[model samples]
Target: MSDGTLRLLLPRFLRRFPADLAAIVLLVLATGVATLAPVISETPLRVVLGLVFALFAPGYAFIAALFPERGPAFDGASASATADEDERSGSNLVERDESADAHTGLTERADPRRAGSIDGIERVALSFGLSIAITPLIGLVLNFTPFGIRLVPIVLSIGGFTLLASAVAALRRQALPVEERFEVPYRAWVGAARAELFEPETRLDAVLNVVLVVSLLLAVSSVGYAVMVPKSGESFSEFYLLTENESGALVADDYPQNFTVGQSQPLTIGIGNHEHEQAEYSVVAELQRVSIRNNSTTVRERQELDRFSRTVPANESANWTHDVTPSMTGERLRLVYLLYRGSPPAEPTIENAYRETHLWVNVSS
Candidate 1:
């Protein structure tokens, strides 16, 4: 029923250290930042910041907990008096000079169960474990939520670790006696760590750290590689005829008059790369034409030249147009494209490249 018992039952933060209540504030800030990340970033920078903040949250909590100030119970005169009484009791033993030394030794030796609490280390380890477990779960849940696409679990993990570190720092600052709180223990821990570095027993921890670091680096680099490299063998090419009037039409007027019948006329050319790869040159086209000739014996011809030159990259397409006029004098005429492939000057083979029109054109004498 005493205040001391009541204090022990309540959370440390509720009992004291209200002014150093920065951890909660930081948690709120990080949450807000993460929520607004999609709005703020055209790139994924907001997501990156959100992840960083998530990692920082626990650390922030730890640090806030570590702020230097003795709690009210520990700072009071009653605690000091208790220490003085204990010292006086020790002094009394020397004055008696009986087998008191032996008796004191017996009592001290008997009280082997008086080891100090490992509560601080336990709390830190518990916090670390909880942070690691919960953050990933939260992140996974967030991913299923509407905004989850932007908020990944890795970011959440970062935030969780940050919060954990902050909490440890804060607990260290607040729990231990002034002289023994951080400095001495930290130095001792450091010395032990240095010694352990050379110890064979510590190799497992080192190996685990290395594995984690490597995995993280690999994941990050994989994302970067995906963003930078083009996909292979993916391209598109399209060609459409643009008439002189801007209407989508292909007519004899669309091409030079000197373009001879039977000789290829360039039509619209288009190239596209759908794969994440580059093509030195590729072409695709859409063609339209009307052929006219007065004499039935006149030769009617439509050919596409192989001279056009261009390049296409993965996942993209281009378009170009060419016109053809028939030299044949024929009452009825058909329009089509003679497709060619390969480098120019040398004849390019046209296997199935021709697109013949179903409609017949009437030639006027």
Candidate 2:
């Protein structure tokens, strides 16, 4: 686009101007990504991104709401000429409102300058506080629903709300005269900061700039180090179990409280390889009486119930069906699934166990 065309599109020197339709398309895509990326990626990542969106999205939406019309901020020198030209053209809706207000005895509201300019550090602080306030209120509302502040629901709700606000912002901006809309002043800020950051007026200012840069670099490096470095010898493997109902739905709660001496209860067992390498696993399912006292557990009278083996690839998972039928009945008995590396150990202890999980099961006649 020509510089003149671009200048007219974005009235403010701070806002960046893009082709009209393209800007809209980009906003839509960004909103979609912010909302739906969690579905494609991991749940943890989705939650993190959702939190980020919650923090910033509300402020943006609030800013847009503040200036639904967003009339350009006018300077004294050029405004009178533009005003007279608008008067001559008979095209200023805002001007007509002033005339109507005079007849109706209602005060006319002028459009916000620089199209609802939120350009200063103080405005930023206010917006951030407002966003923090808005986010929890929304979460409070969602807490009442079945979604219960989950990643997908929160992301979609906030993302959709932000999208609506953005559309309204875009519509208002588009409705404005070419010389009255805001631009995304990226290039302007880049040039200004680069040129001005080091060129301080005094020695103290120069020292302050250097200190700020150093502090920023230190913060960034700390975060980088945290992300890139592993915790000292930290390694883990994930193992889990799930029980299924007759309808093949996973049963997360209300497990059967009573089982007959010879009746079978089926469950699915999964092992995840997160130890950073492939490993063959020998698993044992045992029935035992477990006693816990003073933050310690003691297993006694343990009976071997079942045995199985599997090879799992690194950073992957393997799951299978296992059936348990009580050979003996007892009160507050335990069903333990013990995992060991390679060959089965002579016995399974928590120390030798790569991973283990158990259920507090009861058997009755």
Candidate 3:
């Protein structure tokens, strides 16, 4: 916290500047973008960015931490060449009587398990595979927690894991010698890609490069267009009725079977809007006297009880309580609810209602 403490820590922090700082910075940026983008606006950019971050970054950081040493790069074709190069390099060292003993001592000091260490290509491939494996495992673990696999918990868990792994990787890399640390030579890769794309040798190669660039551009444009302008799906609404349980939770059970005239019963009405836009809805509650003969029912009389309206946004729901008071006494009376998209007609019948629900009850005077 003090100036002297800050000065002492600053040098140590910078003493071994991380070679993979760009990757860590990207992971942090992606986490922030995924977290804030949806709150700011609904866009597919966040989905794409978040998908890449979730499917790659965490595993890559974990792999980096596990393998901080740059493994030997040798293939079948280059084995002989690498051996000859090593022989030539060894010829320059000073000759001494203890050279054999020194070689044996060095070999004994080296870790034999490191002989199976992986190179950059294997690390990258394993990073992607392990990410796919690890992400679902994290979700599975979260399913049992209080969070129950929600967005905020998932993001925090993954983001925190990635950051911790990146820190561990940095520390591990710093512990190794500078030349032995595993680092991504992104600058060199960029330079090589630029040269391959723009600085071709022959006319044929230049023409091929141009074609490749155009193809890449077209592919990117197509994917971006699809993501930005997606087609709308089916639009509909849901209407349901519920009653309060002993736990104060709304459930579709325990309806009042018998109701006295002028007495009130409590019930809940719920609506879910998936219309892809804000919607204004009207609900009409009524009690009807019906005569049933040979399983054919006919409404003899209808009495309107209550009317309610709600304005709900897309992909949202609304719930409200309504009291049902019967003024007419009858046996097996139908307590009906009619839902309309807008204002209901003078006669809101079941045939014309957008949605309808009813419960048969007995009313006594």
Q: For candidate 2, lDDT tens digit of each residue in 78-176?
A: 445556775797775665887655633521223335533554443446657777887777788899987888756766666666667666666777677
**lDDT tens digits, residues 167-207, model 1?**
56656666655433322134445776676544536778778
Off by over 4 Å in 2: 1-54, 68-119, 134-154, 176-191, 194-258, 266-283, 289-303, 307-322, 329-334, 339-346, 349-351, 354-365
Model 3 lDDT tens row, 1-365: 88567656766665455747546657657666756775633677676777777888888888988888766552322344544665887743346548656754754454222455677679879889988988899899999997888877888788778888888888888887765677666675798799988888899999999899899999999989978887779999999999999989789999888999898998899999999999999999999998889998888999999998999988889999999999989899999999999899998989999999999999999
State the weakest 10-residue window (summed lDDT) of model 2. 68-77
Ranked by lDDT, top first: 3, 2, 1
RMSD of 3: 6.0
Provide the TM-score for each candidate, comma-separated. Answer: 0.29, 0.55, 0.75
In order, how many clashes per candidate?
Answer: 66, 9, 0
- Candidate RMSDs in Å, in order, are 16.6, 9.3, 6.0
In candidate 3, list every pair of residues with a backbone clash: none
Weakest lDDT window of 10 consecutive positions for candidate 1: 354-363
Cα displacement (Å) at residue 57, model 1 = 20
Best by lDDT: 3
State which candidate, 2 or 3, has the greater TM-score.
3
Off by over 4 Å in 3: 1-39, 71-113, 243-264, 292-297
